[model samples]
Target chain A: MNERILELFEETPETYVSGAEISRRLGVSRTAIWKHIEELRAEGYTFEAASRKGYRLISKPAKWQVSKLLNGMKTKALGQKVHIYDEVDSTQTIAHKLVASGAPEGTIVLAERQTAGRGRMGRSWHSPSGKGIWLSLILTPRIPVYFMPQLTLLSAVALCRAIQKVCQVDIGIKWPNDLLIHGKKVSGILLESSGEDERLKYVIAGVGISVNLLEEDYPEELRSIATSLAIESGGKVSREELVQAFLLEFEEMYALYMEKGFAPIRLLWEALSVTLKRPIRTSTPSGFIEGIADSLDDTGALTVITPNGERVKIYSGDIELK
Target chain B: MNERILELFEETPETYVSGAEISRRLGVSRTAIWKHIEELRAEGYTFEAASRKGYRLISKPAKWQVSKLLNGMKTKALGQKVHIYDEVDSTQTIAHKLVASGAPEGTIVLAERQTAGRGRMGRSWHSPSGKGIWLSLILTPRIPVYFMPQLTLLSAVALCRAIQKVCQVDIGIKWPNDLLIHGKKVSGILLESSGEDERLKYVIAGVGISVNLLEEDYPEELRSIATSLAIESGGKVSREELVQAFLLEFEEMYALYMEKGFAPIRLLWEALSVTLKRPIRTSTPSGFIEGIADSLDDTGALTVITPNGERVKIYSGDIELK
Candidate 1:
């Protein structure tokens, strides 16, 4: 009914229609139409009104709404349930609590702003209101916990595809989980899991994509290393459209991952990988291993050919692309 | 000063010497001895009265005190700082928060009971107060996050060693992280990691050992599957001594893991693994594979020879021994 009222007001934007005509067109009482208008007005909507002329919606706030967001999200499972929050501490925290309470798989939590956003290593993510898409997907995958690293790569590819589709910008996945454009990180993926030994319950992949952050918005340490889609594309992008596209792409890639295993997704990852076939050194607390990158193995472990011509399997650690 | 008091108390059990004599013998003050007595009494000790008679220790409770437990713990870095709690929601929860807050490596959180104790698969662990040892070890390993499966195997071996030393019972590590005695689970491990992509900040291995639960105390559904040291040994074991032994063994294993690799621990795990050299099938979310148990690889993945004579690798999952 509210959507109908919105449509009626949108159809005749510059003119006010009488309550009797709106009631007759939408099959609702004049009281219902007036109530809907009042609700819309309460939701930060501007309406031009008169005594008997009824209401004409002048404008609606430019913020992500559940109806508008899901209306454009065309994904099978991802974005099936979209939750929009005006402000949150962290989307991942909310997603974890939801998953614990048996929230459906593929439910997404998108916040307009985050007060305590997080990055990969417990770092704070600077999420200014209405400037970035802070989203987290609750995924219950039928895969061993060891293959979780691949999901990070897959999500990076999905984000890159979405950015390319929305802003026509070339984004590459930096090894591990950073999305970079022109050697500057535009997004980050923080994947957190809660599970037992045999079964993985759910993984919350919290993604923070900087869509319109200006140069001054970033911290001094992040100025040289981080970027935004607006900075890379020279224009601001729609957060709703990009988030929808990402959900669609992620659903497709995740489906392929479930059906064909990591082979297909690994190929996609390798294609979008900026560190493959390059000289890289992985540093662990023990020491550093300098080697030439070779390829990803079946289990997603990176196989590196060392200076001594020995193959060292790098399961995981900090990878520095040289 | 307290150590000297305890030493003197243990030396003369039934006698109470003058404070002046003790101060002259230990090169301390009567005030120091009085303070030590006050501290010991605060730690659940009953002391006899009178200034002339000094302090005569009547009895001591078996609570896990940091000073008392660390005195006997022979670990290098694993149990240097012991944080004992009468009750906690979950040691893993506190450990994860502590890890994020830069808690030093080798810090241990031991709880008499866990209100929301967790097992391998987020299942409830029956950790009744004064009944079991629920401990979480904060470790900063130099290995990649993928190799975290090794910690499970290492902890299993360490616990088995400690248990076998005291109870003379053989325990087996069921696949990923369960410790079984007489084909019934006596302990479980929950390993959690937090860090950046590739770089592991810390790994918290929360271990729950049912030391002294009677048969009637267990739920009916768990009676057939779970066993405790008291139930198996027909007597209550010292929880403090068990905790000390576990910390000692964990420190030894952790030291070896940091200095060497999983190769040495692999040998120990193979020796204690009940699933090795048997007909076993591991059920993963991807698929279930039945094969003859071969051995664990250097990276802690279980190697199984399938019926078709092909060796398949099982990283982290449930394994059923047939």
Candidate 2:
């Protein structure tokens, strides 16, 4: 009922929708329409109702609603099911619940603002309402857990491609799972999975894109180091469009990685990598090692040749160019 | 509180302590003790309570209860926190819940019987009441998800040693994660993990040992291929003792695998391997490959040399001796 009313409002925004028109479109009686209007009103919807003009939807409470996003989704499995929240603690937290309840691949959990959003190593993510995209995708890839590093990097590439096409800006991916522009962090991906040796049950890839954030949206500490689409492009980019484009690109990359293996994804990632073939240093548990970035191993570890010409496969750590 | 009462029951199995003694030991009044005893009674615990004498525990519904398992567990972590179930759908199901609740490593989820126990490739595992050891161990190994295959094999080796020490029988691991005796299946391991590319959150290694199941216990279908510890040794093996032994062995190997590498475990595994350097055939999704089972790689893949001398790393499949 809410969808029917919202669609009508979306189509005829310039004029008020008549009661008879709503009843005919939704196949409901005038009394049913009135009840729906009352229900929507109770749910924080404003309607300009008059005797002659039926209802004019003033505003919808949920800004980035699921019903709006699912309107033009053309992908196969990706974004086929989207769960939208007005506010959430974190998309990954809800994604975990969906995984526990046997939610399939391409299921998405998105929120307007994350009160306790986290990044890699449990760092706080600065997400504000009507600013950035805080979402997690539930991916069930039939691969060993070791190949997860590739999946993480694959997500970064997908995000980079999606943003590049939409915003027409240059972007590069950091070694493991960060997207940088002008060597400033604009996006970060955290890929958390549940699996076994042979097959992964589910992988929750949480992508935080600075889509529509302004200069003031970023925290005081991150002013110089952080950026967003609005700040870079000086234009209001639709969050839904970016999300749809990312889902399509990720579906293609994920399917290719699963069918033909990680070689293709690795190549694409290397082409856009800001850390590859550069004099770099990685902080590992044993100690920090300064090396030249060589290539990515099949397992997705950064293969670097140290000063002594000894090759080292660094699994995970913060990487910096020397 | 339950543990305290169980300890008291364990100490005085024959004689019933007075109400005053029970209250003093438990730091509770007689009314509190009576309420606890009533709650236990409602939960299928039978106790003989007198006016002056305290509760004499007559029988515990589950013999290998959590309290019994943790009585004298010497390990630092493994099986330190046992979650016992009288009857459950699957230990893996409960283990996932514990992982979500951030249960510490060495936490165990065991059941007397599983109505819906499952094995690899979605096969049904026959778990009967009071007959077999159906338990899942939660290990938080701080390793990449890719190295899970090695952990699966490591678990197989740990089980082999534990069963040998408890039952005094020779056992062999079937390629990836199965235990065999006299060419018949005696145990199986299912290593399920949750994590991302960087570090794994937890690995729920579900070990199902056919300890005391008779030939009749298995249906007509599994009788020919499956055998039990009691069937092979002709003696009833204690499930609690086997669980205790397996936890200890697993903790030791897990520590070594963390401090050292897979080298020592691989050597021990090779010493007891029955499939190594033998002619074998594996059924893979691509096709069947007949080869000489040569050795295991560092990542625990079975390096099989095909008839034409091509090396094939069989990740997962059924194996048959040619």
Candidate 3:
């Protein structure tokens, strides 16, 4: 009933609905309508009540509003089943638990804040309360486990397209994980999987996008290196709209990749990449290698040409532009 | 105290120890020792007692004897922390649970019977009570996920070597997983892993070996397709000795793999393979392909020369000799 009322308010954002009309349409008493309004108010929804105008929705809470998120969702599988949290240790941890308990593909876990957010290679991600999109998407791709790195690249392209659509900012993807705006990190993706020898059981693609966070939200060490969409756009970005856009974009790209292959996704990733054709240094498990960032191989590995004219394929590494 | 008693009896299989000697060595009363012996007898251990010679171990239960298994375990890590079950759904399932709860690498879960054992690609495995070695070994190898298939090959080689050393029967590895004796499968390997995009978190290598199972032990449908070490060797094979040998051999091979990479393990696997240089038909996800098995690529993928003279890499498939 509350969701229905919220949907009614969302349908017309600038108008007032009379209590008598709401009661008649909803087949409820005036007192019941008033009680629901009070409940909404308690949940941080603001309304303006006047003797003649009845009630008008003024503003929604800064926290996630599921009704608003689901209002204009266009994705088929992605975000169809959503689990929202106010605060969590990490959305990825919750998603792992959900996947273990047989959560279907495209089931999403979102949090308003993460006390222990993580990035690729077990690094920390800064996620302030109600200021970023911290989410983990459960995916069960039928592709072989060797092709899993392509999914990370696919996610980066999806997020870049979604951010471009939502915030109108030109975002570039750093090889493997980070999404950047003017060389400052705006988002990061961490992809984890559990599976058999050849096929994957499920993958938890954890994406943390800084949306509404200000400069002060980042820690002192991360202030210069990290950025948010609102900071880059010079305005407060709507987290709900960004999430909806991302889901739609990711769903479309995922379907494309599943139908076509990594070729299309590789093209999109290369177009949005800030790491290609540059001198870079990578700290890989095999040790450090300094080379020119060349191109992606078929399995999504970055092929780098060393000073000695040797071509090396880097599977996973911490790369920095030189 | 029971394990100590078992160790004392195992020290001199041909001799017997009086109750007075056991009481003195274990610092327990004769009544306490007698109570423990009653407990052991209730657990299917047979004893022979004489007027002067107190007790001799006549036979142990067909079930796994954890005390005997640990008595001469030579490996440093493998099977160091063992969990034994008389019956389980699957050792792989229990191993997954254990890994999720922070069980260390090389921890093992063994069961006398699996009510719902699984093979590769969701196939069912027949595991009757006390007739086979059904176990799952938890491994935390510091390797990329792509190299996980090599672990399966390495396990097959280890099982082949172990079975040869213990049972002295010639065993051959069928391309990806199966261990065959005279063209019939004697064992199968199923390797499952949980990990990040590039690095593996842990691997559960489940091994099922038909050790002491006779012709009547298999189901009607499986009798023609499966053989046991006992059936091949015309005698009852010691399940404990075979398991110990496997643990030792696998531990050594796993260490070698971690240190020297997959080249040596690949050579060993190829030497034991019955699939190479044979006309074969493989049912892969891409569809059916008939070819002659050529060799293993560097990453352990099976390379096959098709009838059209195209060399295709088979990452995973069900193959049969054409």
Candidate 4:
């Protein structure tokens, strides 16, 4: 397998391994081993080969390589098929295009930096090169499209866990998909879908995290609202490590979601929610309503207790924390 | 005002009145009449003016001409601004692009036919030239994006009312956005949105109607599952008349939605629902449940009484009519 070939090259650095040895180790033909080595070389691996010295792995790019990203991903399908874009306008837009073209479930779109990054409520997210994790994950969940709200909540929990494990900082979820540190936004999530009445073809979760940007890197307007991991952690954090942690956490939560339903996730989300049990003003199309946040129902709708004590379930909207 | 200018042209079809006469009739100066006539000419209208001869309405395209389409449409902001596309891949895609570019509310995209028409669940709809209505309406409703289900239901009611008034044939809303006549699909609606937590920037509702397609016009494979107005009424239907009727009905329903709430529309929808009080198979991502359709809850979820007599609320999924 090419995975084994990669492992062999990783094990021996600057030392050539013979084709016969690789074929013996992996029980494949010399031609096959040479073919795999050629493929690895095409994927930015510098392999030196000779009749006596088999293959020597020279160098690997410091960038986020697809092979390295998927090397440790633990899932049946999530993130297995990925598209790496050097630059893109919006990952969410690309994900929708992929879904329309019958891209497999769990196909991910990762960009070095988005030329036109978007945030919650059509706001622009500043995604500088190599500063944050700007990626969109495509999910083809068998769940009804209406239950899509849970995906955002689940993502918040996963992100929180990732940050806590990596930096050991106490972060909180701001109602929907905002990640807050001392009441400032460090990350945001946007969930989108395309489906019909009964069947959902795909859902794209566009995640933008302010991982390593300095205070100067942020726009002058967002200086007060946006914070990054380096600013909070006081040191540069490894983006690969954070992405790995986030992916692992997401897979775990997604599995639990399928097994136990949104009740357990709702419980976890409520524990981390900064808006639950707080008074908030939600502006709907017709008018605005001030209500206290109750709890999430089984379907992932946020139930709000109005001034009259009537519980009006808010399905999807922006909540202004009072 | 162009509205007054159009009125004069309508009242006197054979003669072109001088700018002075039009100004006197509309109580405006000659310059204002000239400006209004220029605007009308820009909208594909031809004007011939001599010393006494007025403007004549020469020709109007029967399919989705902006002037003719908005002639009878009523709304504060919806459908007031029209964009007619002679051919497009999909109107929804174009609408999304327009929304990103700051297109205003009530902007409409009407196409004579789609080169690659799309339907719900990633299916293709047959859009024969000049035989169907392929249109999308861009709305920036001030509602939580999750309550979009209610909008779909509202549009369904509007569509059914239009059909009833135009064709004198009974049509029913099939649980979601499908318009069914005698258990076959006649029209479908696909609603997509672009927004973030609680605030939707824009929502595009792509509607497909099999207007004047004959039985042979339909692909042989779709003959069993799809029907057209010609097949249903045994006579050719007017595309302009149907479009006008739909816009009027939709505007009225949208107004009622703003005045009252979704309760009244839900009541009307329940009355026309063929799935209610019937044994059916409801399939969700979790599993499949065979049950009797009881009613729809406030959040637009279908309450199904499972075979075990347990009421399970299905927020989204496919339902099979038994």
Candidate 5:
């Protein structure tokens, strides 16, 4: 009933739909329609009210609603089921719950804001309200547990292709997974899994894309290290199109990964990577490793060679480089 | 308070401890002491009572108490903190919760029986009450997530050594982590991880050993493929002793694996392995591979030299060998 009311308003955007028309079409009371409007308003939807004119839909927040998000999506399996929230601690938190309840693969959880968004290695991700793509994709991939971490690298390539197609912006990828634009971080991926042995119960991939947040929106410490597509382009961007493009790209990449293995995806990732062959310094568990970022090993580890010609395959670390 | 109640019974095993003396030692009423004893009894504890003499400590079921498991554990980290349950759905389930709640590394969750004990690749593990060692160890290793699965193999060797010392039975370790005795599986290991990117949040290693289960304890189907220590040794075995020895072995092996890479553990595992240098057939996702088992890779994957002279790395599989 709520989605029907939303559809009536969304079908004729920026136009007023009378309470009588909505009630007649949806077989609900005018008071029911009013209650629906109030609920949508609580979820960040705005409507202009007039005494005689029922209600004019000033805007529709379908990006924060599953019904509208999947109302006309053409992807075969991706985003077929959508979980939406106006606000959340993190999309991944809700995704875990949904996955445990047997949500199918390709199910997505999208949040308008994340109160405690997460990044790699317990780092805090800056997720502002109603800005950026704060989404987590719940997947149940039938693969060995040892190769599960490779999904992080596969998702980066997929997201990179999506950003290019939707936003028409070329980006450089850091080895392993973070996305960079002009040497500043534009996106980060966090993958968490629940499984026993070789089979995964569920894999939740949390992706935070800095889409429209301005320079000042980031904290003082993050100002120099983080960026958004809108700030770089000096224009507002459509997050909906970007999201649709991402699901399509990710579905394709995931299909290819399952079919042909990571070899082909590795090629595409290496092509878009800028961290290769660059001077780098990484803080590993043992100590600090300073060397030239050489290549990505088969397991998606960043292989760095020091000045003394000793090679190191670093699986995880904080990287610093120009 | 619960641990204190358990202490008197454990302190003088098979000896009578007067109720009045117990009340005076713990500063509780005689009725409170009786209540605690009843609570313990409800959790599968059996006590012998007489009119003149107080409760005589007859036997102990370790799953009802955690303090007994850690009372004299010598490991610096492993098994220092133990969570005991009379009957759990699964120890890994509780271990995951504990790890999420900031349970330190080497925290152990031991259960008398699991209603739904999980085995490798989602198979059902037969865990009879008070008959087997059903435990999950929580580890917070500082290594990369890709190398984390090797701990399962490291654990297999540790358990093998512990079993050799406890039961005096010569066992053969399958390529990856299963412990086989007389060509039947005696134990299985399941490794689960919660992490993002390259760093692991925590690794939960669930180990289930069929220790004292009788021949009739196993189902008809499991009788051929699975055997208990009691079934093989023709006598009842103590699970508490096996657990303590295994934790000590694991602590040593884990310390060595971290200090020196997987090389030392790999060598030890190779010495006890029966699945190496043999003609083997395995069903992988790609297809079936018939090969001669060559060696173990650095990541503890079985390196199989196929008939076509290609070395295929089998990460996880069901192996039939001659």
Candidate 6:
């Protein structure tokens, strides 16, 4: 009944829909219609009521509405089944639990806000309420566990493309996981996996993007190095639209990766990367190495040529451009 | 109290210990000693009773006794905490449950029999009752997930060295996991892991060794290919001694690996491997490839030179010697 009432309101979006008309259209009493309106108002839907003009929907809630998001979704696999949350500790945590219970590939968990969002290397991600796109996508790829880094790079490319297309802002990848705009971090991708033997059982690609966040959303420490699309583009962006675009782009890129291997995705990642082909110092698990960023190897490791004219492949590290 | 009784019996292995003397030494009544002996009998221990001679220890039960196994054990970490069972679906299953409940590294799970033992590629392993060593050792290695195959090779080398030392027989590893004697299978090693991101959480190295099985213990299909240590050595090997030797050798090898790297373990594995430098046909995940088995790469992958003069790294596969 609420959906029907919403549909009637949507038909005449600019004008008020009378309670008697809504009751007649949905075959309910005017009292039921008024009660439904009260319930919708409690859920953050704003209604403009008048003595004779009836109720008009002034605005919808900032919280994610599953029906609204899926109304015109374009992806085949990704985001086909989504679990939306008003708030969560982290989308990745829920994704892990869902995977343990046999969640299918492309299952997505989204949250309007994260109380304890996580970044790479155990850093805390800033996810304000209803201001960004915070999600975890579950993928069960038929590949060896070593090839997991490729998926991380692939996700970066997909997100970069989606943000550019949806928000009309330039975004560049900063090696392994970060997305930057004008040399400021705008997004972070963290890829985690669970498997047995050499085969991968599932991967949780957790992405946190600062889409419509204002300048005050970040902490003082992050204000100097962090940014959001709204702050960069001089206008707020729609989180729902950005999420849909990301899912579509990610689904296409994932299909291409599964079919043609990581060659194309590597090329895309290199093109969008702001860290390659530069003099850099990397702090790897073993130690620090100063070298020129070379290229990505077959296993998605970053190859760096050191000053001694020797090439080294780095698996996991933090890089600083010199 | 049971451990004390066992220690007293060990003091006079070949002679009888009077019940009255045992009661006096332990400060227990004669009735209590009788009840303890009955309980020991129920646990499969055999006792020879004589009215005048008191009691003689005929033989201990074939079931694994934790106290006996831990007595004089020569390992630092491995087998320090052991869970012994008379029957289980598989030791690997129990090890996984233990890991879920925060079981520490070097925890060991042992079973006298596995009704549903598993091998690589979902094959069923033949684990008979009280005739072989079926165990799973839990390891929490601080290494990248890609280096997991090295642990598998390390385990094979450790098991090979231990078996050779304990049973006084020549045992060779076949490429990745199988242990063979006289070109027949005697043991198999299966390594499994669970982790997130690039770090490994834990690895369960499930090893099944046919220790004292006779020819009739194997089914007709496996009789021609499977051989036990007893069948090869013409004597029953002590299960307790073999388990202890394996745990000690594995702990030493694991420490060396964590200290140095896979280079040393690789050399030991190569020395014991019978699969290198031979013409072989490998059925990998991609397909079958006819090649000559070459050296192992740094990641512990078996490299094979194909007919087209291409060196291909075989990650997971079954090999047939040509």
Instruction: Name the top TM-score candidate.
Output: 5
Which lDDT tens digits does candidate 1 get at residues A58-149?
A: 55644775677878878988889878898899998898789878899999998877889998656788887667899999888866556677
The CA lDDT at A302 in model 1 is 80
Against the hidden reference, what TM-scores do the models get? 0.74, 0.78, 0.79, 0.73, 0.80, 0.75
Complex DockQ per candidate: 0.19, 0.41, 0.44, 0.19, 0.41, 0.30
Cα-based lDDT at residue A141, candidate 3: 85
- Chain A vs native chain A, TM-score per candidate: 0.78, 0.79, 0.80, 0.76, 0.78, 0.80
Steric clash pairs (candidate 3)? none
TM-score of 1: 0.74
lDDT of each: 0.79, 0.82, 0.86, 0.76, 0.82, 0.84
lDDT of 2 by residue, B1-322 (tens): 7668878888968678777887898899988888887665544455676776666776554457555667858798788787888889999999988987999888998888788998987788988767788899888877777778779888988999999999999898778778889889999889888775477768899989998776655667898899999899998788888899999999899889888888888988887788898899877656788989999888877899987889998776567866
Q: Which scores higher on TM-score, 5 or 6? A: 5
Decreasing TM-score order of the candidates? 5, 3, 2, 6, 1, 4
lDDT of 3 by residue, A1-322 (tens): 9998888888889799989888888898989989998877644466777887788886665788899998878888899999999879999999998987989998999997788998877778877667789999999987777777888889889999999998899899988868999999999988889878667878999999988766545556898898889889999898889999988999999999988899999999999999999999988766899999999998888999999989998887678998
- Native-to-model Cα distance after best TM-score fit, residue A93 in candidate 3, in Å: 2.8
lDDT score, residue B316, model 5? 74
Alpha-carbon RMSD, each predicted model? 13.8, 12.8, 11.3, 16.3, 10.8, 10.7
Angstrom error at residue B165, model 4: 1.0
Model 4 misses residue A162 by how many Å? Answer: 1.3
- On lDDT, the leading prediction is 3
What is the alpha-carbon lDDT of model 1 when measured against the actual structure?
0.79
lDDT of 4 by residue, A151-176 (tens): 77898898888888998776888777
Query: For every candidate, what is the interface RMSD in angstroms?
Result: 3.3, 1.8, 1.5, 3.4, 2.0, 2.4
TM-score of chain A of 4: 0.76
Least well predicted 10-residue stretch by lDDT in candidate 2 chain B: B38-47
